[model samples]
Target: MAKPKILVTRRWPAVVEKRLSKSYNATLNPTDVAMASNAIATAFAKYDAICPTISDKLPAELFPQSRSRVRILGNYGVGFSHIDLDAAKAAGIVVTNTPGVLSECTADLVITLMLMVARRTSEGERQVRAGRWTGWRPTHMMGAKVSGATFGVLGFGRIGRSAAKRAHHGFGMKVIYYDAFPIAPDLAAESAAQSRDSIEAVLHEADAVSLHMPGGAENFHLINAERLALMKPTGILVNTARGEIIDGQALADALRSRTIAGAGLDVYEDEPTIPAALLQTNAVLLPHLGSATRATREAMGMMVADNLDAFFAGENLPNRVA
Candidate 1:
């Protein structure tokens, strides 16, 4: 049988790239740049499967009006909101994403952000880098205490539960979470997290809050001005899930007014284009490095490879979404 043709939309780790080439007739994006919508549409007509990252936008408009040659989209990340599942279903295209592989790494980044924002580590680092730091004093760089504080988690999924473990056991912090669906009692007990009935409750009670929710129309602006107002003035916010989950402009204003203590964000509402207010604030910002570690990235790629293998073999895909 002929090898199923596949196109990797962006550059993946070299080891995974080599593995993919060995498994299938794979074409790597040499420039490592995002493919335009038209290019993606054209590729759909040519390839059996297309591997895409979060950076690629695959809206319903990009899918062919009728069925096309692309049988599957092997997404590299856990989130599938970037691809329009409705359109993929309409076109009879199967969609799969790498989920379990990056959970721990993303949880690590969540904790890193929570600590950085709460302790104002970024500000202090900036001062030191600019040679503006004076001698250490009692009042110098005083920040929030993480120990014994309330750590709120929005969307108690795998990443959120891992963060709760860190906060509860590692830092002696109390963990509380709110999820759209009720969390299983065993899972909640495992994390030592108290489940809340609503997002407002979590916002009002937490000393620091982390977001681990899915992104889409329903969750857009989940943390807006009114919601941010629900938080205590000393509260800190961390977002490693998706950018549209929080209103960046509202967060910026809150930071400027000291309505909230600080914020840490790994993702943005607009990729590569951040609001000026957030850039100017003491907020800890990252360029979506939640799953950037070599191990996690490689694992994600291998997971995608597995899905493609199952798809080609006419077997059930392990991570099929559509």
Candidate 2:
């Protein structure tokens, strides 16, 4: 029998590439750029598995036409919002994402963004870079405090719990969170977080809000104008989750109108095209750096490899999106 054919989405670590080259017939994009629908159509034509990322889309229109082909989409990151699940289901393809491997890295990013916004690190950077920093004046570039502040977590998953641990243990923050399903005892005990009855209550009480909810229906634009308006004028918003969770236009308006004090975003509604108004405002914007760490990337890649090994060996996948 011949080896399985796989199409890697982009350039990976040399070791991983070498291992893949030995284990299977792997095809990589010539330019090492993000996979497009046309390229996906072409690549999937001969390959059995298509390694993808959150940026790649596996629409039905681009499904492989070969009977020997069945997808094992090896997503580099946890988020599968880019992949059309229904389309994949219709195409009889199995989609896999590297999930737990990214929780710590993303949690660290969320905390880092929150701290940056609360402590005005971005402003300080701006001041220093613009050569405007004459000295450390008493009231110059001063921002909110984190200690003794109330922290609101939107969805308490592995990443959320990790962030809550950092907030509670690192700082003396009062922790409260809202989840559709009640948080398990392990999480509450682990993070020292209190459960709130409603998301509104969490918004009302928290000095800073961090979102970690999974993205799907019923969550798109959950934090709209009205929800943003509910936050205190002194409240700070932080999101390392999906960009669609918050309305960028509403968030921009909120910042302009001072609806909320400030915000830090690791993701955006549009991946590369951020709102110009947000860029002009004091809000801290990040270019979707939630899981950008080198160590985390390697782990994600390896985990996907493990999932593939399990699948090819006729065992259960390590992390299944379905």
Candidate 3:
């Protein structure tokens, strides 16, 4: 039988790429650039399966009006908000994502961001690199303390739980969280996290707030100007979740006006196109490196490969989201 032709939207880890090449006729993106919508629409007719990452935006308009030859969308990341699931479902396309594997790494990044922003390490590094450091004074670049502070988590899922553990056990911080769904008492006890009634409650009390919720229309701009106002003036916010969860402009304004002390973000509302206003602020920004670790990224790719294998073999997909 002929091998199933597959198209990987972005360049994956070398080991996983080699593994994929052995199983199917795989076409990996050499440029590692995001594929255009038109090209993605074209892939529907050409490939048996199309593997996409968080960077790819597969909207309803991109799906073929007619039935597509593509059978499955093997998403490389846990988040599938970038894809139009309804369109995929209507077109009889299966959608699967990689989860669980990236939880620890991503949570680690959340801690990294929190610490960087709280300690003003980014600013200190820049000062030293610019040859402007005149040695440390007693009051030199004094920043907020992280240990024993209240750590608020917006979503208490796998990544959130991991972050909570780090904060409570490693840093001796207090853990509090708010989740739309209820978490088991035993799970909450792991970090001694107390569940708040709403997002406002968490924002009002925490010295550092971390976001780990899903994105999409319902959550678009969930943390707008009003919600941001609820936060303590000295509080710091960190977002490793979907960028659309917070309004970029509002956050920028908050930072500029000292409404909030600082922010550390790994994701943005628009990729590679951060707001100029935000750039002017002292907010610590990273280029979406939530799961950029070599081991974690390779694991994510392997999960996608496993999903694709199960899909073609007529077995139950391991992480089917749609």
Candidate 4:
């Protein structure tokens, strides 16, 4: 039997390449860069599968261009917001993601963001770097306290539960959550998190709000002007999830006006181009780097490779996205 062809959208872990080369003709993207929709449509034509990241855009038009032999798409990241799902479905393609493996890494980053914002890590670093720091004063760079506060988690999932474990158990925070559906009773009981009726309810009640919802039409601009207004003037909002879920400009304006205290954002609507207005604010700005640990990157690559291996071998995928 002829070996299948693989189109790797970006350079992945070396280990994944070695395994893929064994069973499939793995071809790396010509450049270490994001491919345009037309480029992706053309390049994807020669392969049976393509592994894409959040940066890559797989448009609906590309589906029909792919050869009939193309069977699966092995996504390197967890979310599929970048892909046109309806197009992939119509083309009879299977989409798989690396879900459970990166949960802890992302969750840890969420907590890290919350801590950095709450504890004034970024400001202190800036102060020191700018050589403006003298001796510590009693009221120097004071911020919010996490202990004994209510932590409102939005969208309970693997990452959300992981974050809940840290906030509730490690910091003695009371965890309240808002999800469309009830989580498994056993899991909810184990996490010790209570569910809220609505997102507004969570916002109004939580001392800090951490978002974990997926990015899509339903969730786009979830934390808008009105929703963010519900937050306590002293509360913080942290998002390690998708960027478009929250309106960046609105949040920036809110921060400037002190609507909510501050925000810690890892992702953004126009990535690599944060709003000019947000540049000089108290917001803790980080490039989209939630699951950027070396160990986590390796695990994500391996999981994608494993999915590709299973699909090509006619086995059930461990993490199918569509």
lDDT of each: 0.93, 0.83, 0.95, 0.86
Listed in order, each prediction's TM-score against the native is 0.98, 0.95, 0.99, 0.95
TM-score of 2: 0.95
lDDT order, best first, reads 3, 1, 4, 2
Model 1 Cα shift for residue 56 (angstroms): 0.3
**Candidate 1 vs 4: which has more TM-score:** 1
lDDT of 4 by residue, 112-195 (tens): 999998998999998899999998899999999999899899999989989988999889999999999878988777568999
Stretches of candidate 3 exceeding 4 Å from the true structure:
none
Each candidate: how many clashes? 0, 0, 0, 0
C-alpha lDDT of residue 238 in model 3: 95
**lDDT (10s digit) by residue, model 2, range 1-322:** 6888888888877667777778888886667787667977776557878888766766556764444265677777888877777777666678888888888988898889888988989899888999989997788877888988988999988898889999888898889998889777986988689999998999988999999876666589999999999999999999998888998889999988998999999888777788888897778888888888788887887887888888788899988884
Which window of 10 residues has the lowest lDDT sum in candidate 2?
59-68
Instruction: Please state the error at residue 137 of candidate 1 in Å.
Output: 1.3
Residues 95-122, candidate 3: write the lDDT tens digits. 9999999999999999999999999999
Give the residue spans of candidate 4 off by over 4 A. Answer: 65-68
